[model samples]
Target: MKLYFINEYLGDIHNTGVEGMWVYAEITPSKNIDKFNDFFAALVDEENDFEEANFSEEWVDDNNWFVIDDENRKKGICIPAVYPDGVIAWRWR
Candidate 1:
């Protein structure tokens, strides 16, 4: 099983009434997201702090994100999204 972590940052300029940040993680087949269709949904339940967040699939860069004590070795992939006020988003897949 593998853990996928996803997050989004809505910067000060978004003005979408979105603040702070979001984080989510789930366990699935290693390096194969196709094996876990319900992964994102599970994360919504797993990450109680960010229940309102959502996930979208895309290619992520490796420069904008990092793993903090990722014992599962699942933190590395980074999907980059540019938000207003230089906000950066990332997802580990």
Candidate 2:
């Protein structure tokens, strides 16, 4: 399974239920792929530590990360910008 490092925000915008805020970190690969099992284990441990340190939410059931601001708004999802990271960009489709 491929791993992704993401930042998420949870908040409200207008008169609607808001998923709030989200932010993503630079997603990097587990370097030591030779020891895939151990590498994944270490990654999991590191991910847990990171969650505890920052978002307070574990990287589990990574579905439904965000919601729209108004009930009438069409359902859409946010995705990473096409350009390089740290570009302060987004593609909401």
**Which stretch of 10 consecutive residues in model 2 shows the poorest summed lDDT?**
81-90
Question: Candidate 1, overall lDDT?
Answer: 0.34
* Predicted candidate 2 versus true structure: per-residue lDDT over 1-93, tens digit per residue: 122224333222322222335333332323432223332243345345423233223332234233333344433334322112212222234
What candidate 1 gets wrong by more than 4 Å, as runs, is 1-74
Every candidate's CA RMSD: 13.6, 14.4
lDDT of each: 0.34, 0.30
lDDT by residue (1-93, candidate 1, tens digit) is 222334432112122222344333322123443433343334334446433234333322344344443253435545333322233344543
Q: What lDDT score is found at residue 42 in candidate 1? A: 43
**lDDT for model 2, on a 0 to 1 scale?**
0.30
* Cα misplacement distance, residue 43 of candidate 1 (Å): 24
Off by over 4 Å in 2: 1-9, 14-63, 72-74, 80-89
Error of 1 at 16 (Å): 17
Error of 1 at 82 (Å): 2.7
